[model samples]
Target: MAFELSPLDRELSNKTINENGFSVYVSGKIKIDRSIKDIRHPRCKGKLHSSNLTTASVIISFFEEHWETLLRTVASVLNRAPSGLIKEIILVDDGSSRKYLKDELDNHLATAYPSGIVRVIHLEQRGGLIRAKTAGAREATGEVLIFLDSHCEAGINWLPPLLDPIAANYKTVVCPFIDIIDANTFEYRAQDEGARGAFDWELYYKRLPRLPEDRYHPDEPFDSPVMAGGLFAISAKWFWELGGYDPGLVIWGGEQYELSFKIWMCGGRMIDAPCSRIDHIYRKNSTNFPKAEFGDFVGRNYK
Candidate 1:
């Protein structure tokens, strides 16, 4: 007897067919008794092992003209990363006109690391950083997600510091101490005499001189007033649950400030680890201002 399927069951069946190319139907009832293994999608056939689940996804979002810097950043990550830690490096190209990034990155992936894990997502139109990050976040597959700027260079054992805190059940956001790179030459340098700092109401990020006692207690972990978005890690679930980065912010001014403040004000703590470090080149002049009109949005969001 062919029983009529309800709208809900029909919708589910359609989705399953579209996603897995197989639909579940019981012998006579509406219950779905088929195993996912029975799906006929060519990509679904495999002797899946649980060991493959230990992978991590690293996401980097960048715009035009940062291709070389991003390549160097990925190299640094691959060099210092522990074996069996990262599963994939996701590069979200926010409307870059450069053709070499795709060519160079593909060649490197083929010869250097052939895990078939390097994925590139190119947007047809330029979306700001928050949108780019959100797009990359939706496509990530690792148990843990680490976010880094396109121009960051990682330190030794950098992955462990970020992952360790989350593995120990810290749902809050984790960030490493960022050292600065010379804007002119892209050469890395130690933190300046006055480097550790946060953003003010004016949306300008400024550094303050380390306290005399700060040098004496270099080994101690302390609560930070804000987490720098250049490098931070969080469990995949919590990130989406908190609604991710606010999609309302424009190109690149105050999105980090909004994220840091959201994490602190909405029941999550931000911590800075002295043990982990990354170098970011500070551009003396940035051309990221979308419009003079959008400046008010920055003030309202951070104020």
Candidate 2:
């Protein structure tokens, strides 16, 4: 259900876009615990997961993220995932200058979840996304470490399929089939087609046709040479064994390819769990992010 905005509201939303690179006004209007479509394969509806899937610590790193969308992401995860399987939700603040993200965020989470499933880590300096995630992983206590962008909404039954594979083989890494969440109207929908993760010669992220065998078992996980990087689950032990993200890769660039290739070459595998769907908001415009001082960090990381 979409909200009808008044003329004044529309004007405000446009202004909000300039500030956050998305319609924060529209995101604020939507219920924090709003329901989204399941958007999974037909066979996924009745698929059974292991009764004893390992617990996970979901780590989301954000800097200057919109308040409403951030809250909604946590809400969707809490509402959809089984309480026992979620050891904690860690929000790593990458030195956000925004006042509201400071005390207000801490107070809200404390009041809303008295059981303390959510924790926030405030970095003294802006360590970029790569460092922020590594910081969050260092404090995680769960068997699995799940990384998600600050603006994603977990679809129905999104957790089990991801954790099940890791439970079977600790070396396996699983990523959800990411859907698209509209940046403007905040509409939730599926991506046009399903493709496996791949990369070209220049190390640019690319997608290839799903294997022919994938059609036979549409609900099962399939091999992906690389992960989209924004959302995925990995065993905490395996993640640390692989040394997490390279400390040298400042900000966001080629960490996806780095981690993906490392996983394959180091005798581990990456898969896209078909039954697990997570909706991500692809921004209509670039946010007012600070430029990284590190020169050619992308090229350096790829090298």
Candidate 3:
């Protein structure tokens, strides 16, 4: 759904866009538990999952994320997912400078979710996304570890599809069909049918047209050459076996390719679950954020 802003809201939205690279004003107007239309294929509606699926610990890493968007990401998971399947939700704060993110966020989670299902880990020093996620995984106790961006909304019945395949084959790594949330208007919409994850010679992330056989089975999980990096689920056991992200790789650049190659070479496989849909906020002005100086890290990691 898209929101219509007033003249004053537009001015505020523009300010947020300049600051956060997205419309924080519009995101603030959205309900924490806002309902998004189910855009999955018809076949996905009747699919059945194992009754004894393994539990998952969701880890979200943030630096200076917008308040409402982060809260909505939490709310969407709590509201839409089955409670029994979620072991915990861990918020990894990668040295955020925002005052509200410190004590205010902790207090809100404590009061809002008195069950203590949600918790926060504030890094005293800035650990890049790779290390932040690794820290979260080390602290996670669930059988599976699911990594998500700080500003994403979980789609209806998203967990079961992702878990079902992994439950059957613990060596499998699963990625969801990522939909786009408009950076300016806050409109929720589908990206497309689907495509295979791939990369060109330069090692930049790219998508290949789905094979003819994959097009014939739109609702089933299909093999993907690489992951888009932000959203994916891996068995806790398999993740550790693969040694998580390379400790030497700083910040985020070629980690997706690194993991994708590890999955294929180490007697494991990566699959894209069509039934699992996740909406991600693609920011407009990413250059506004201060860049961490990790010179030649992408080239070094890719090597």
Please give each candidate's TM-score: 0.72, 0.96, 0.96
Question: Quick one: ranking by TM-score, best first?
Answer: 3, 2, 1
Error of 1 at 117 (Å): 2.5
Weakest 10 consecutive residues, lDDT, candidate 2? Answer: 288-297
Which residue runs does candidate 1 get wrong by more than 4 Å?
A: 1-55, 192-197, 208-216, 288-303
Q: Residue pairs in steric clash, candidate 3?
A: none
Q: Write the per-residue lDDT of candidate 3 for residues 155-222, one digit (tens) a residue.
A: 88999988998899999999999999999888889999889998988888888889999899999899
Top-scoring candidate (lDDT): 3
lDDT of 2: 0.89
Estimate every model's Cα lDDT from 0 to 1.
Answer: 0.63, 0.89, 0.90
Candidate with the larger TM-score of 1 and 3 = 3
Q: Which ten residues in a row have the lowest lDDT in candidate 1?
A: 31-40
Report the C-alpha lDDT of model 1 over 213-274, residue by residue, as the tens digit. 76565533346666556678878877877788887765565777777777778787766656
| lDDT for 222 (candidate 1) | 46
lDDT tens string, model 2, 1-303?
455778988888888887787888899889999987778888999998898899999999999998989999999988998669999999999999999999999999999999999989999988788999999999999999999999989999789999999989999999998888887778899894468988878877888889898878888888998888889999999998998998888878888888988999999999999888899989888784556576666677777
Alpha-carbon RMSD, candidate 2: 1.5
